[model samples]
Target chain A: MEKTARREKNIRRQVLVVDDELVNRRLLGFIVSRDYEVIYAENGIRALELIRKNERLLSLILLDLLMPEMDGYELLEILKADPALKRIPVIVLTSEKTAEVKSLQLGAADFIPKPYDMPEVILARVRRSIELAEDNIIIHETETDVLTGLYTKQFFYQYCRQHDRYCIDMKMDALVLNINRFHLVNELHGREYGNRVLMLLADNIRTLLNETNGLACRCEADSFFIYTPHRDDYGELLAEYAERFRSAIESSRISFRLGIYENVDMSIDIEQRFDRANLACTNRRSTYTSSYAVYDTQLHERELYNEKLISDMDKALEEKQFRVFYQPKYNIKGDKPVLASAEALIRWIHPELGMVSPGAFIPLFEENGLVQKLDHFVWREAAAQIKRWKDKYGRTVPVSVNVSRIDIYDAQLEEKLREIVRSNGLEPNEYLLEITESAYTDNSEQIIDKVNLLRKDGFRVEMDDFGSGYSSLNMLAALPIDALKLDMQFIRTICSSEKDLKMVELVIGIARFLNVPVIAEGVETEEQYLLLKKIGCDIIQGYYFSKPVSPEEFNKLIEAEQKEELLC
Target chain B: MLTIDSLREYGADVDDGMKRCLNNEGFYLDLVKSVIPDTRIAELEAAIADGDLDKAFETAHALKGMYSNLALTPLSAPVTEITELLRSRTQTDYSGLIDTIKKKKAELDSL
Candidate 1:
């Protein structure tokens, strides 16, 4: 009894009874109102008004065909035309069999003849129609996002899964769009405004995809994913969408980064396809020139390489696979070259891969925030070698170690360096610090402050890779440094081109005037070495003298140089 | 006086008609009385005079449905003929069929 009452209460069958004749309306009302709440409208005009007002409460409409002023047929057309009202099942209560057929063709739910048809028949048809409409509403709610009316992420994945075979047969592409710096926008503007921007973006995406067989979903905050069949003009379509998005959010200046996976493997899950696209998007985030990336085999291979290198870094460090090689700098003022200083470079020898160049892993580590660990290890090892050299030979050449940009932000940098030097019983000035010119790009003021503090504590600071960055000259004037290491590119081309040779001479001349010595690196040939010597460059460190060598070989070289000096 | 037994005595299928009304006798009786007072005959005549075949067909069809619901087959038969003619948009004199419907409706009202 309770279930029956509850079910009846939830039925809510409010039927609209439209007729011109009072007797006809009264008669139908007497029969139907027992089971349903009947709303009477004398004609189609009044029926339309009631429909608009009580659209939500109304489950079905019982329209009479012979009514005046907007007949039942005309009203049916109007209801069918409206998306909001079209879902309400309309039962045409027409006397004419012809009208019944006509009404059904015009999208009516059912037709009941007038003249007081069986109340049971009317109730049965009405109840079934309402039930079906309610079911549809429930399905619609679950499948769509309330704000954007796009498919929800779960529904989208389900749809893709269901149509996976179709997609593979048709050759489809999946694209993921991510808004750049969306969190910053939310931080600057309120979340409401951010939601408005998202809505506008969704509208633009829908418009762009109107012509294609595509499915779009709001995957997460500020991210939209689309799967579309492969089209010949897919690139053009994306470009157009980018243009539209830029216009829509012009005030916010919100831009989208898109990643597209065109070569889809049917065997993989749809989420995996989206992951590949997202990976491609992340790869292009730092680039300013392009707003999109296409996932390919090469990018996948590079990603694998990065993963392997990151995983192997700690093991490589623990095993002491990393060795410090010293490249000696020569002071060429006299006929016999004198060893002035050496730069400490780190070399990695992987057990399986043999020699892994610094270029391959250094940038990778820096990106993953692991380069700082490598930097500290190199610093400590180099300091220990300096101490060993001083103890064995009674004197040691000053060695400079590279300090990455990430290391410059370390608060204990100065303290760490002082500790390392003091533990070795060497003056801070005896150990040189080589900072790249590009490291000044990040927080130049802080870097300059740190450099000044290091110099005040008696450590020699050399600006490495001069002329390689855009603002090298500007930094040179403001930076307090002991020397400038000219980039190898300048030395490499100096022998081939007079223009390069002139540029090198000009740099050397400027360094001399500033009372800072210049060390020319990458001097592989005798001709390049003679050019540097003639230009009065203070130090020459390149392949011509010696490549970076192991600590024992470096010690032998230094001893040999001492013997040669004694002979002279 | 329009009782179910009396309807059956007048050759009306009261059982079928009552079943169509979900076996509610009161509601079925109301439907039968409602048809007795209908103005469909006059409406059908005026529609024919105005040459509005759509409206004519509508009124004729309404009369047919009312007679059929009460199981007044004789009254419903002539109306059905005229309704179909109007539905096909064929120009023909409907006066004879309209007269027969009036006679039969009066007979049903008396019963």
Candidate 2:
């Protein structure tokens, strides 16, 4: 019973019957009134007024060609001009065969003969046209984003897949744009304001499109994708777009990062093209000077390398592929060279690539947040080596392992370090912690507190690469550290530039005044070693003494130094 | 009364015409009665007198469709002739065709 009621209600939607003659209007109304709620208009002008008033409730229109004040053609021109009104199908009710053909050419859905001869044929044609129009409205709604009227991501990809040949023939390029820190805009403003901004952006992107061919899509939040014919100079085009965006959201101070991938590999899927362009956009995340990047072969290789490293990292740790190398620091104040301490550095020996430098993998691991695990591994290995040396030689020099910024944030850092020391039967003083100078500059209060906590627990803390960072002098005054390792760049240029030499001397003097020992790293010449020692530097570590060596070689050097001390 | 049988007597295929109207014979009869007095004939004559060939063609064509729908081919044939001539912008005298339509329309109205 409900189904029958719904059917009756569905079929009773208003159908507009327009004719200049009252008799013809009444005739059409009499034929269709049983299935529809018929509305009559004597001329096209009145029909248009009725259509505008009942645009939402109207399902179809039956229009006679010979009307006054506004002809059927004139009314159709107005209706089709409006996006909202065009969804309602208009079927021409004309007596002339020529008018039927001409009406169809002017975007009419179908034609019904006048004089009410074929009531059933007219009804069937009207029903079919309404059904088809409704289906089109549903499809259009699903394929478009309601907020921006831009193609949705799924439809955009499907369109690209279907039109691949068109793109190749046109020499198109794919560009992905991201609003930098857009979430901050939503938080600072409101979500409604963000929606308005997106709508404005969509309008601007539409202006950039070609009339017939190009497409722009809203891929996801704050990201827009476009495919257009390749421009001769994309950098200039992107600059103009960036400037436009900057002006559009002037108060928000928003910027855009655009990544472009020229369509060279036609065989690749459209989604892969978007992925490559997105990867290019991510490459600009850490940079501040530029807002656009084009995907190239070098970045592709680097991306592949990063993927390989991420997949291989766990296996590398389990297989013990990582080795720790120790660079010995000598106590330069003594007449005879004596071992004071060492810095433990990590090295990776890939099964296929031989030895991989820390430069290749450390930054990659740090980005992926896997450096903390590697840091713990290095700490445990260095502590165990120190314990072994103490057991064998009856004495042991403390070795410091480099800790990354990611490790400092770990809540388990203190407990993990203590566990490693206790498990190896080593004293807390036996292992030292070395943190880069720049790490102290980030969240200095927290880093200072952590360092203080570690020092109070008996572990010596040293600042590495001290002179390289901007806030070296300020950190020296603020941090509670035992020693300072001078940056290698300062030491390397000291022999060449007298100003650098003077800077080095001043640094050592500051360390001395602070009652902290100073170590100069990367010393390569005898003259540099002599000059550092003469300047009251307490320790030196570089190629001049010895390069970073394997654990066994470092133990042999320590044994040789002990024998030399006995002879002295 | 101008019934379906009367329309059939005037060379109108009432049976096929009724089928086209979804067998609504009363509706078809009412349409014929309504079209007999439509002012479009005067509009067509005025358009021809004004030398507006486009308007003349449109009015004649509309009348032709009305006659054809009722299957009144005898009335529709002469209007179709005038419509085609005006549509093609042909320089020909339409007096003979107009006379023939007048005669047919008088017969249709008499029914």
Candidate 3:
């Protein structure tokens, strides 16, 4: 990287002249200095020191055969062994008649036979060696990625074309492999661990290319493009890659999603073929069951649909087509379930399409970072509603809103939320922030710092979808949250899946120990409600109580509770 | 003043030496005269007299290169012979070769 940074224009080329005798150094230095800046080293040790200091600038080294302490041959051996310094071409300046074979064997670039070159012979050889070595170094640095040793994207595409030239009528597949949630690897583990994962994947990718007669390049961070011979089925191959990768890394948390374009259209450019592959790979997420996806017409249609939705997102927000629905959460511990805070969920009503599921657009928006806009709109709407509900019912019922992973990552999120609360004549505690557990598990320290800051500002943060994460028990105790919302998936099969029920119980126990209430969502059946109530769940929200309804529908539920309280 | 002609009179390869110095005659001649005070010739003599062939080899090796680079063939010729002899760690008398080098260097200095 230092060498890469040193590759700036207008740097004067330098040559290191290593010789014990001052006159010999001066002689070679004079000749080399005509075309390059000259550096003199008295002996092998001094030469190595200068070489290291000026490795990036030195274009050539003029080394004498014999010296005191460390000899020229010894220095040659050391330089040849080193990957960084070896590229600087060395020309042995020796009068020794028999030193030619040995010097050349030790990796001398060119030899300037001594006594004296009548005129420009030595300088000509010096220039030639420097020019050749420089050309080689430039090619090497630009050809491969420094980290993965894979072809750089430009060179990858270049090599792919050359491959076609040699093998006529060769049917190749353009495949792009991407790591899902790769940032989490860098967050959950350290950056070093993340680099190790990339290196491991690259090594396996190299082997795969070798086997399939392919070429691959690391196109971007956590993204690689591979060009290989066409295959009918990539399913088994991707599985094998997954198995090899999982065993190599020893973590299921890290997964690879590969996109493939088989029998590529020879008419299209290499980059465009890979672009389609990348599109196909990203169409489905890592959360999906399949490891690899192949590009097809149907997939292209879905991409067009998604593109349409993405294009209309800004207008939808402006026209107020997105609606905020409130689902009532009940405190189930008392004699009867008491009305508690409700969760604010977004539902979009498109002009063309009557209703779009939150599941459809939320993920799409999250992928492209438009979720923050929708989330902010919801925050403003929900805060204003809380004010209106308080004035109508004469009681302040706090509402919990989804604080997305992206929203929490925003540097000004806390200030934005505080501004919303202040403008609405409500306390920060009246608006709860629901952040997903996966967010905490990804980058605990940074998110914890952000959450602690929000809590310090009197905002109650609840960890949403708690039981679904791969969070360690140690991390659970350290979380700065007011409540834990059990992931709905766990509650959906708690009675059927014994393991799921035990996980829920374990999480609830951990939650109780932390002195925070546990909110159970997706409690649809009576049995789920009774079982959750028996297990000391503090709050419940699902169809068993009420589905996510509009504010007007939710207002009736609040009114019914008001009448009961008045009668009591 | 050591003109290139005067140095050629003492058998130094003044033309070759100047060419090696990028055709600077004054610089090449000045470098040639510097060999008179070089001290390694004397060191080679002393190290050989002390029977330290290892030190003799090192000093002779240095003088061979310096003389060869400056194109002082008279001095370099003897120095190179002694250098190879010492390199083989031969027990021969190096006084003969060392004195020849001193005599050649003194001749060039007198020029």
Candidate 4:
């Protein structure tokens, strides 16, 4: 029932249309309005305005070049300039066949030749474009910004070299459109409304150009860029197009600020044109925007800094700058001194910046496809730590570690784990593998098979923080897990409310029935521990025992406990 | 860099500490409260103590909320744990759980 509700909630489809001709706009709108909420503009400029207005609801764009205001080329330049809206796949519809070829070269995802074939064909293209746009949105959200839908700065730079190579080879036209004083929007109406502005801007631009040749992207928090190749002498045509684009901005109900780049020195290639426009946009500070500037030389320097950030990030892992820390887990019900089971938390000990948390770097790593390296490092580290403990303690305690969903894609997860186990001279049974419920969703059969294989080898598997994922039953039933870690939230409830206590008690009972032990996490207080004990929780770990400590500190704790026991 | 005996000692201390927490009711309650919201306490307690039908609903909702938060998830882990028990409210294991809770509380009061 819940899944069904979620699916229903996810059904909204938004489409944008940009055209210089009113007839084309109305025709496209009439055809698509039934399936998607369609927004239209007569020129690329007006499309950008609509994009800025309704960014959130937009899914696909049908762009037409040769518009009077902001010709398709200029519109594309503006769209690609902003990283946020750049993912919206454009289907360029232009009468000019030469322009269609140029549009493809300019980074247009698809080009629709002049004149619609049939309504079915148009619908098919629209459907395909929407799918691509939605996929792009998913990619953007998982790895980039949810609001602007831009390639995360980390993701953008990570892909920079390859992207630049592709651009140069294809001679793609690109532009960087920076939104001046976007901080003011965030500062004024707050982030939510500012995001709305970006959405609105992106949606409007998406609709204004020939769908095949144009794209609007959110490049940064405040900056945006669009790129498109010029097939014909669009210099004169673009001047008039810029006016319409400006007028569309002025006509919008919301009081949004604006800027533009058009009619620059046109002799250069597409990338140079984008550069010129960005330069012109930057030079004239006093002119209240809704004014257009053509390409210029200044934009090159601005791009250099981005290139450097990307390059630096690329080398971050190879430099051996990352390290890990362990947090101890305590079990409340055992009436035994809490054993330290370390959660292998990672850190980047950047040479210059001191220390960086996984919270900061992990997301960046995931975006840039560097997470695999980090995962490998973590696995090796955990294995090494466990081995060290086993050599000393003789398998009396366990070490818990995290794994990412992406690691399963490597096809060597089981092999790697086995290798690490064998290399460390450690029994797999002594180490506990902790995984999130989400990981099960990625490749359930493979994950279960591998985990079960590990279990068969005597390794203990614990589904960490079990109560918060989509498929708990499936995970428990399919995988050979030894224990289930109750998330801290379950434990928190026991202290504050009866609702939580009942729940905890129930979980304990169920686990007991299944012959699977339950570990309540985040037991911070004495009362929570008491409640967990009452509920028959097999094990409990939290701050109520002790926070994570260093090996030295942990040794001290053991000595103190022994002394106390002696006194008793 | 570390000695074998010291590592064994560390494991023993952790084991003992974990055992101590198991029999302490107040400790469990406090741990639960710290991690969950305030609004759910009264109803959850009332349901568990009295076995009210409404308590089941309230208990289920609270468990769902708490488990989701702790797990940093929105799915079935913690809530499923409780719901399974709640569904089998008449099971003998449920009684064992309640007795465990009482014993833990007694331990904490003694402390």
RMSD of every candidate to native, in Å, equals 9.3, 8.0, 17.8, 46.1
Tens digits of per-residue lDDT, candidate 3, A109-136, equal: 9887776575478777876787688788
Return the candidate ranking by DockQ, descending: 3, 2, 1, 4
Q: Whole-model lDDT for model 1 versus the true structure?
A: 0.82
For candidate 1, write residues B36-90 as lDDT tens digits: 7777788988889899999898677666666665566777678878877987988
Chain A TM-score vs. truth, each candidate: 0.66, 0.67, 0.52, 0.47
Retained true contacts (fraction), each candidate? 0.42, 0.48, 0.76, 0.00
- Over the stretch A330-397, how does candidate 2's per-residue lDDT look in tens digits? 99998866799888989999897689899999999999899988998899889988988888998887
Query: For residues A1-568, could you state the per-residue lDDT of candidate 1 as single tens digits?
Result: 3643465676757989888766567667766787789999999999999999998889888888776789888998999999999999888887656777899998888887655556766777777776677778877898888887888999998898877755557788888887778888788888987888788878877876786668899988888998877655655655675676567665656667888888677778899899998888887764332277888868798888879889999999999998889999999888877999899988999898788899999999999889988988998988999989888887878999988888888999999999999988889989999998778766789999999999999999988888786655676688888998898899999989998888888888778767899999988999999988998888999899999999999999889987887897
iRMSD values, candidates in order: 4.0, 3.8, 1.9, 29.6
The lDDT of each candidate is: 0.82, 0.82, 0.86, 0.60
lDDT of 4 by residue, A27-111 (tens): 4565667567887888777788888777766777788776565877877777787887777677787545678777877667786
Q: Pick the candidate with the highest TM-score.
A: 2
TM-score of chain B of each: 0.84, 0.90, 0.93, 0.35
DockQ winner among the candidates?
3
Model 4, backbone clash pairs (residues 3+ apart or across chains), number: 142
DockQ of each: 0.24, 0.28, 0.40, 0.00
| DockQ head-to-head 1 vs 2, winner | 2
Q: Indicate whether candidate 1 or candidate 4 has the larger lDDT.
A: 1
Residue B9 displacement in candidate 1 (angstroms) = 38
- 1 or 3, greater by TM-score: 1
Where does candidate 1 clash, by residue pair? Answer: A118-B20
